[model samples]
Target chain A: MTSNQDHLPTGQPDDGAPRGKVIVSVDAMGSDQGPSVVVAGCARSARSDSDLGFLLHGDSAVLEPLVARQPALTGRCTIVHADETVTMDDKPSHVMRHGKKTSMWSTIGALKSGQAHAAVSCGNTGALMAVSMIQLRRMEGVNRPAIACLWPARGKHGFNTMLDVGADIKAEAEDLLAYAIMGVTYFRNGFGEERPRVGLLNVGTEEHKGRAEIKEAHELIADHAEIGRYEFVGFVEGSDIPSDRVDVIVTDGFTGNIALKTGEGTAKLVADFLRESLKSSALALLGAMLAKGALGKLTARIDPRRVNGGVFLGLNGTVVKSHGSADATGVAAAIGLAAKLAQSGYHGRMAERLVIAAQAVQNAADASAQNGDRS
Target chain B: MTSNQDHLPTGQPDDGAPRGKVIVSVDAMGSDQGPSVVVAGCARSARSDSDLGFLLHGDSAVLEPLVARQPALTGRCTIVHADETVTMDDKPSHVMRHGKKTSMWSTIGALKSGQAHAAVSCGNTGALMAVSMIQLRRMEGVNRPAIACLWPARGKHGFNTMLDVGADIKAEAEDLLAYAIMGVTYFRNGFGEERPRVGLLNVGTEEHKGRAEIKEAHELIADHAEIGRYEFVGFVEGSDIPSDRVDVIVTDGFTGNIALKTGEGTAKLVADFLRESLKSSALALLGAMLAKGALGKLTARIDPRRVNGGVFLGLNGTVVKSHGSADATGVAAAIGLAAKLAQSGYHGRMAERLVIAAQAVQNAADASAQNGDRS
Candidate 1:
């Protein structure tokens, strides 16, 4: 891959992928569906864009034949053999202490060694985060790394960037400020929303609502909006997430994770109920059959597989965690996100913005300390 | 107003409202739709159940003509005239300090004066809570009052009781335990579920997940479950809110409020998307027309108005807060909930249960404190 290939635009994709040679390392053995699905997903991703490549990490004996069967991945992938694979039940601490040779660890190692611009895994989230943090490490000036996922919303970009979804349980006022800054950049780069509108997630849209931490975070984010290169939409309620009112929604991991799951569960329950209603009578069933294409479109829009990846933000190297139970389509979506981030040089830009934001944070603290002294 | 009226079964209703002659105090002028909708809603409630009556608190000049037009309300409702109405923009503090003569205040006063079994208002939530807290006061062992709402769920009861939705932002371990006890009682009495399973909402279902407060509350709730007459299901994730596995979900006001709104927003967004897809083409439109009845049923199942009330728990007197913008149907649903609680003697039963749970809590705290001293 030449240096020129790195400059190729990924935002306005011509073939649904970056028009550049970008390799995303995959933990082939970590997926619930095993190496076959991982290889198939890689093939599916590569089929669309010939410039895409993969460094598959797993047992060569298992992954070799799997990669070879796919004509699209014939020469587009290389299998990096790993004797161990992280299981769903594997604890993050245990994996960190004794599972260095696991496929997930090897997958992160590829990014560390500059073998792959990005990494994708359908493994245990805790173990993956543990391995990535230990290997790739947090980006400079980041107190904690956050996991960002795209939420389907009423936006021109078709989504909103939501951060700190189960990355860490607690986010203080300062940490929330960092999340806001990072979330802003993530939305701008990922969704091409320049000056993305950011909102602090709270119980109510009112300024007086929520915990003390949330109130302080609201002030900090609002104060630093200009420096963060985003419009501060103040406090937004959970309902505002899917509304077109905001682009980036920032919250602590505890709240963010719950909101994400709650949103998904609600959508699923509604779909299930609608399906049951449609099947109640013969006329309704016939109507369902006639509107099959339209209903299919609706299902596709709300489908979990359509938005399968949660990108690890505030990390030195980009890593996209695909759902462990994800099939080929889900894995392909995760890989596409990783490829897009890699091609756009998201890491360097995010780090640069964080450094500038950190300086502003320092100046604000200094000014506050001086004021406190005077008082 | 016989004591036998309070003992009459409100559950398994033969009619839509409570069987006995239970008078509900309604703030006629508090609704965003004004006094007309409140009168219409009262009429709707009265039309279905001849046993039900109402004390309508507001300007009699404004409410009289509306109530007269609805013949169902003519003899069932008594107009209690009040000069002022609480506006949505009125702060709770202002309402508490200087707005004593408002319709909201008069409505709650009926409960304190024993003129009404339960109070119903579509007023500003903060003002309602403030007036209720000041007028009726918290129950004997209650730390803070919580607002419990019915969530549509996959259960035989067709709903789950979720508490502390914007009642207050903070709920400590003890407060959470109280919520669990209160929520359990509410679910059992309302849903007719014996030993209703209670779950503490967190990011993950794991025991170690979430903040220290949640973990401590988990143990406290588990310890007092037997005394509280509910089964402890341990920690549940946000996705489990509507799942059949849990019948009662306990959380702080902030998280609970967000979860409620998020769930509602997601459902609404999905419905809107489905509607757009249904009208995407002529064939789809024809199918929609044919399946109109089925779709209407589905819409009704997920409709906000169908479950419009949030019952104020832990108070000395029962209060049901309806949506300020609720229409006639929405207000009727709220009145039904208030009537159900009134007939079932929910306040007395809940208070008795809390007394037992409070003793258990006291014992646990003493033991822990003694252990701390020894250590």
Candidate 2:
């Protein structure tokens, strides 16, 4: 591995960008496509946005030549070499106990130490969450961290914000309230939507439907809508996730994880079936040829890689998780999302908003308990 | 309301078929398309399957002319006039209390009195479930009724069976185990799969993931795999819902309902986006015309109307809930599904399988409690 002195120091203005530019700390190892794609993605971002820089963490022996090959990243990157990598199959507990030398840990370290504003990794989700919580720890008054994703839907932003996709399976009423506030912040910052409408995910839209925790969450989220700076849509069914009725959806990780995967699986299934059907005849082949341009456009619109990042929220700093199998294009998308969040100064504002949400939840709990006592 | 004698009696050699033919009692009112579609759908089925018969429940004034218009139903129909109809906005509890005169209630009555081998309705889901539960009651040893659906997927059968989609949102460990057994039985009897692979839906595939109920259900379902007459694949994530790995997915109604709707929403979103893209350019329009046959084939394969019924399991009699907005083709498909179940004698076998499942769960609970005492 190359020594730290081999790279330029922070705010050296190597790329003609100011000190206030957002620098994304990237874990350039462990992904299926390897570090070449990661370097290419960083170069792509650097080529598009002069105000963005990258602090790439990996084995410099492997990464140095890759970075040198990209002229766009010649003066816009700082390689922070680490000796090890966290494999996809590594257990979160095992990695947490002994993974300090890994590139993923070093990437998060850059964020923790303020060397970078945001972090991006294509590592195992569980291991990343464990390392982030152990190193940077949760934000003030946050019991559990959440992972938020942009769901492609019908809206001004073309996507709806959804949280707790797989951070943890269990979330009590209070935790859901915290997610509501965090999701609102994410939508506003990432999508540039002011006062996004939020909804609680449930089996039905009726107040009496869903589990007890959901009912409690409904009351808490609705009661503090004014403080959260979002309109409370009360409850929404799964179909509403992609509808224009709301801009943000909040749910426990168990439900959110399944909903996310189910949506992806359904889309993939449709695509597969359509391809097979299109190949069934000569006429279809000719038609597919003529419609290739239109079909390509549709493919681009629904491509998961175009929206490839899940932000780990309720943590001390923002960490975006890209798909492990993502190529250069997908990795670049994730980095772009991370840079946007960092540029908006989302980290500082998030802490302030979450504290207020915590207080509102406590007050709601107290009022509910008093009513329970009376009954 | 017309008198009961206005309708033909059961097994009166009506449709030129023998006494063993499957007869579906259909609620011919309250659907978004009204009684005309229901009558037309029945006529369509009667034309396709010469052995099929219908027990139609609705206003005789409206249904008589519609049924009489179709030559296929010349001697194949029986009309049980029901003046009242349950609207979509009616409360389930309210319907259960004062819905005896409603068409939905009358349709369930046909199943209860054994006047029809099976029941199908396009009424409100909540109202339909409520009326069926009261009229037929739950089967012995069944705790909560479940609504099972055929999820379109890739497999030998082209679909997977999922249960507890909406009947009840809360399913305990024992209830989930029951669903596993019920799902396997439904898959076998409906699709003729000798031994379907079953999986419990959870946040992840790991043993340590998900809530307390899921963990318990995992153990209970795994322990009684041999007795359940299916292979227990343990836990499955959301993406596996459509994979070839599992033929049956058992989950609580809350998660199952959300997953179903989420899948539908994603599919619709893709279709809409694809349509918009196809219409964007003249070249694409010409291509679409050339590929029209193949595209139509794809649409037919994934059409919801081709699989429109949601079967209410754990009931003394079989009941299928069709989509409220179904056309004649959709209604015909739902009635076809109901007729298949009735022909297989699914109601009687489901009861026996559920009783054995209950005992298995009880045995596991007792053993666990004994271990707790030792601890």
Candidate 3:
């Protein structure tokens, strides 16, 4: 489906800041509404960034109409005419097998084959993870891949990055250490943190509490030299995410997924509750006026849409997974997030650091083994 | 230890309602603070409920001064003098083997032997679950045991029942059905609902989502006669716990724990944030004054202390697990709750209902197996 000769037109002039030429392959037919929203998002992204090029992979007929709607994107976006699309309900194995023909699969293939700098999709997360793992594979010294997302916090547009949203359901202590290192790198590079403080998600702030894995992970991270660059602030709970307690929060995928959705669900409930309370009666309305500013600031600052996507870490290349129900704006934001990660070199830095840490831990263990200090 | 015959003075006559004869066995020396707070909580509980009795198992000499401070409790509460106490850090297996003389063991024994109606503790949950599994055993026809708790919801001063708080970490679909039946029965009897609506926690309200287990469990529950009795609303998210969405929300223990704790942590954080915002400046103080009434009402409704305790269901008897960090008042409220559960015959009735339902499901499955009706 690489018949883009007819669609290719003159590219835009380079802007002041030398924008790195990034080819982001879009799964044009993956989302709930098919290629329409994806095409729109890619069009928006391409128009805003001159160096960013889009290799839209889907049915050309489906793309032509959507492309017709956006005149500005006609020359900027390339259509890779693929016939198949991956449904959200399809098994991960099926997607992995026939992913070459499907838009989502082809997108990952583009990244792996060096045709695209990064790939972005709002399709089945399981399929994305599986296909990406098959095509791109894990980074050096990384055991498990993690999905890291930005959690907006309390400061001026304040946010903290969190990882292992839904990559591995069951994780080990070493998996958590990997998440900590990846999350630290994601934040440091993507958000420009010098030394991000990593907090382990636990039931309490105590050292001995939480699951067995987190406790062991804490010890491993604390002793690792590369991870030592990250200010390991021991343990933090789910509430600490929005309170500006730490720069990065690390957890297994199961807990992290629940926490993320819970936060999203609660925020919506709170907003709804406030609206209902405000409109219930005249007295309540008057009371609402007093809270209007503080409440507005809080909600705006913590808006999930502003940080609408999560980057799957430990993979060989950048692959951002937008929320399945993302609108055009959200998908665009995800594409932007993928671009930032591609430029940041966060994954490379994190991979290099992880190798050093793992080697050091292995060396220490080996020395201790000689000394008969297994405990 | 049960030798104080004169201390069983039962006459706190004529409060109109029947004064329940409840004997609560306390593991007086297991928590982080040892027996100090637990003894204080028990003493406070005894004073509050005149008909309440305790088999406080621990060193009688150590508990004597604490028990002495409460004159009213001295009459009804008897020290079940056991010198040993289980340490929190001890392995569950170790405690099970060498725990005979330990206060935690003795107190549970009191319940199993029918000396007490229920058992209460702030000790290690893993140990408690293990001990209870061995001692009390599962109710008749129950396959796997689950821990249930009542989380406070808005509206009436009632609680919504949730189960498998920490009993079974990784759950099967059938396991969730057991949790549902147990949760509903507990809600009906303990919380006085005739037919509680059961909502399964999922990422979204869609029919074809969630991890594999939740999806399978959803169908099983829909067809089960016991589950059919309740208003089986399809799916609900974590945020619905606080607001009135369902009478009982069912999930695996892992997700349930995170959701419950996240709700708690969110409430605490929002409350803390508001309080801090109020004290920030004079202008903020004026705003706070304007919104004080609504905020106060909101805070009171969402206060964690009001619903500090949770019931550990699916046991052969009643057992309540209060928050480890619960204060005297919170402990007293939990004790009061346990007394009410005993008075209501919640556990026995729930067990009876579950037996009937379990038999029906097994019969249906057996019939299907015999007929070779795979579909």
Q: Is candidate 2 or candidate 3 better by lDDT?
A: 2
Specify the poorest-scoring 10-residue window by lDDT in model 3 chain B.
Answer: B1-10
Per-residue lDDT value at A302 in model 2: 77
* lDDT, candidate 1, at A291: 93
Candidate 1 has an lDDT of 0.85
Which residue runs does candidate 1 get wrong by more than 4 Å? Answer: A1-19, B1-9, B12-19, B373-375
lDDT of 3 by residue, A1-375 (tens): 112111111122222312478778888877876678888788777767667888888899878889889875867678888878778777777778777788788889899998887889888888889999999999877788999877656634257777888787667887787788888777766555677888888755756566677788888877762444878888887667766668888888867877777666655555555455456566656666765666655554445656777889998998999877777777777787777667655555777877876776678778989889656
Q: Is candidate 1 or candidate 2 better by lDDT?
A: 1
Give candidate 1's TM-score: 0.93
lDDT of 2 by residue, B1-375 (tens): 012111101122223322466778999996898889999889888877776888999899999899889999988899999989998878899999999899999999998998898899998887898898898998887888899888778886778988888998789988898898888878877666778899999977878667899999998899888887899998998888888999999999989999988988888888888788889999999998999999887877677777788989988888999988889888887787777667666566767888988887777679989999999
DockQ of 2: 0.68
| DockQ preference between candidates 1 and 3, better one | 1
Candidate lDDT values, in order: 0.85, 0.84, 0.72
Q: Is candidate 1 or 2 superior in DockQ?
A: 1
* Span of ten consecutive residues with least summed lDDT in model 3 chain A: A1-10
Question: TM-score of chain A for candidate 3?
Answer: 0.89
Which pairs clash (backbone N, Cα, C closer than 3 Å) in model 2? none
What candidate 2 gets wrong by more than 4 Å, as runs, is A1-20, A59-72, A81-84, A89-94, A367-375, B1-19, B68-71, B370-375
Q: Estimate each model's TM-score.
A: 0.93, 0.90, 0.79
Clashing pairs in 1: none
